[model samples]
Target: MTARNQGGCDGEHVCRIVDRAGEHFPGSRGKGLTARTQEVLDDLGVVDEVLHFGFRHLPHRRYLDGDQVAEADPHAQRTPTPDRPYDGGLLIPQWRIERILRTRLAEHGVRVELAAGLAEFSQSANGVHAVLDTGERVAARYMVGCDGGRSTVRKALGVRFEGETKEQAMLLGDVELSGLEPDAWYQWTVRGRGFLALCPFRHERSWQLQAVPFSDLGAEGSFPEPSLPYFRRIVDDLAGGNGIRLSKASWLSTYRVNVRMADRFRVGRVLLAGDAAHVHPPAGGLGMNTGIQDAYNLGWKLAMVCSGARQSLLDSYQEERLPVAAWTLGVSAEGLPRVAERFVNGGSTDIADGAPSDGQQLELGYPASSLSVGGDAESGPRAGDRAPDAPCVDSSGTLRRLFDAFRGPHFTLLGFGESCAGPLRDVGTAQRGLVKPVWVGAPGSGADLVDVEGHARTAYGVTGDTLVLVRPDGYLALRAPGASRTAVRDYLDRVGVSRSA
Candidate 1:
């Protein structure tokens, strides 16, 4: 099926598409958290228009104390034009996504559109149809449900989303704080008034603040926040004697904690992806990143399946991403109670104390199921490792880098000196559908990078004419001290990327 990029009232519905279009890719290195996120998206080539069909009529607002927050253009806050590295939202800016998607997707040959409601969907042979919300029903052999926590498609299929909603309700508000430095994240915890965290806001000279709980009002208080005094009190206590002031209240709402995961991610022609399959608390900022990873894992697999590259390639998606998602849910579950405990006791965790591990981004290895080589052997930084990106030099005797070749979809083979070039090149091209080799350093450069007296060799271990084959996902598939055709073939067979395509 042709990819449709347009939908959502204005062009704003495509923010996710634009947010990741060129953000994540090989060779595109970035500094700071937000830029890193963009590079991740760019490397993955998630260049498509994202559709924002989440419950719209559900009371959305962007408030500014007395600043008149403007109309619901939908296209306003679509793309994340990140200005700094440490801008403090757990993930990308929590608001104005669709607007960015509109602009980003257009460049990738996709359009954004907004539709009112779901009119129909595709069902199965037991009286099922292959269609969706729009009246135009197109039948496809496969369907993946990415709909959200309350998934309509999952329910229709009789799949259960099991989990409990937390009894503790929070009065959440996003506000701007004045008289505070724009350079850092400020947080203050109050005894009975709830907690407040202040951080930078994108675009304008405003800051974003959140006041949790706001009040001790029971869940029966009907909707939290008509109780402005309670919220103000929390803000007041958090400010302490510092005389801090807050204004430009943005969104004020209530959220009940929830954690859930689908019993199964796939059933026949339909599959589950992102929140449609699992939902968890907003701790650690894993929610959105997890969903984006889900998209990444599935996108390439789907492309392969649709392109007829391999049939078994499709099943690996669930095998690879499901367990990772499950582990993420587990980690998130562990974090929720710890957060509450910290709030209740006024005790600081390692995070609150500014520990080194606080902001270290998570990088997960592809699961054993996703391993393409050395299945039973030792794990990590071995054959079948995501070839790390580092600086290096070319055969021209000039300093370049390793990531330059790792960017797009090309077979990457690495070797040390001129002696191994003929063998490496011969072995790489010996097979028509597999393997491509590239030499690093120059002829007679005194063996591999180990002898070069630089960071490049130390980074990639080019010591003594090592030969390494890297996979498309940046992992190393094989490493040999010398050129070995048998070793290369064995590594290829182990990873299912054999010469016998």
Candidate 2:
């Protein structure tokens, strides 16, 4: 991976590899013993490192238009249910997130080469050959371009980036403020002029400032260089002597909003992911989250194919992700105007209210992918939907969550109700290493799990015998009513994993 930034989805990929290896290579632990290496690996065992600084719930959003308050939505104050631990989105700085991921990658003996980049590459029928900027030659079965919007790999593949750049540019910067609460979001909009927003960064004494100047202030159809003085003027104009003052400045930039995506995610053996694949406004905070998800979706599929799954499986990356990117683009675009309108007219701000659920990203799924197969259309989560998490009791009488069972790289076969027992056991025996089977029955029935309070059954939409095969990325691959072993077997075979017996 030729990553310009060593965090975000790149870090996530490294963590996923470590998790998978732990499950599959349990016996190989400490075989090649090195004291230092073991220590690093031990540190990487912190499974929650990915969400180390994440918020328990979304932060409250407050909207202000000049001195007048327009709306305040404390959506993040909602209590989290057992099934849904994260009630809203998390707010963590990108740099810090990258640091945590880098630490994990180091444990796995993967070091990111800073200042190094992909110089050139070519692909044949079998694999891809790449030359790094250091003149190092490397051959691999595949190459992924997670290299931001100005991806060299995507350009080399001649993929068209289809989208338009907004005529108006916005000024963004990080600075210290003399007066402002660090708990809520603040914004000011002058009707038909422009808008200014200041949100508290997670870091102390720092804030993210965004300004869109009114057309009359020479902001429309042109770009302006960002400077400390320029930012101060905008803050003064927007705040109108509200005791808010910019004390010190750190980083600044001028950005033109561009919403575009590659015409194709894959061109032969090279694939596009993250900003290389799509770029849109950060209206719904979708940028980083979407990219991380794109990596998660592609990682397991790539692993499967490299281990003898069909090459055709790679095609589904585009099929499943392209539409999602397009839809996300539309959502963010639609939200921009709504937010601007709220700043201008002082009506109820849909952007603030909708963000809790809209930005949670729990609704994203791959229902139309070739890998998703058979389930009742009218009831329950479809084959392509996200597998909902639920609380349950393990066979050992310990409490566990569905997410715990789905943590590893292998497929999860969930058999709900008593009727599913025989087929579930048979499928478990047949699939062995590739599938981990869990029989969910009533409490005290001696199943692998006892669905106490019927949480699992309710969350899974299973009233009777049902078998759900969840993919490595926590999406349903197949849902067979009546616990049909044939359906499970056929779906597995189609995905290039055969039954052992």
Every candidate's CA RMSD: 10.3, 8.4
lDDT of 1 by residue, 1-501 (tens): 122122331223222211112222211001112222333444544322111211111111222221223223222232332111112222224343334544555776565334422334554532224433345555454566666777766886788888877765555555566676554445555555555655553343444455564455575433445334555666666665656676656555666667888888767656778788888765555666666667655664544344334445667677777776777677766776677666655544312222112222334546365545533233225653345555555554565445555555445677755656665767667744345666666436543332234444455555576667665555565666555556666655544445454
- Could you say which candidate leads in TM-score? 2
Q: What are the TM-scores, per candidate, against the unseen true structure?
A: 0.70, 0.85
By TM-score, how accurate is candidate 2? Answer: 0.85
Candidate 1, residue 421: CA error in Å? 3.6
Query: How high a TM-score does candidate 1 get?
Result: 0.70
**Candidate with best lDDT:** 2
Weakest 10 consecutive residues, lDDT, candidate 1? 25-34
Which ten-residue region of model 2 has the weakest summed lDDT?
25-34
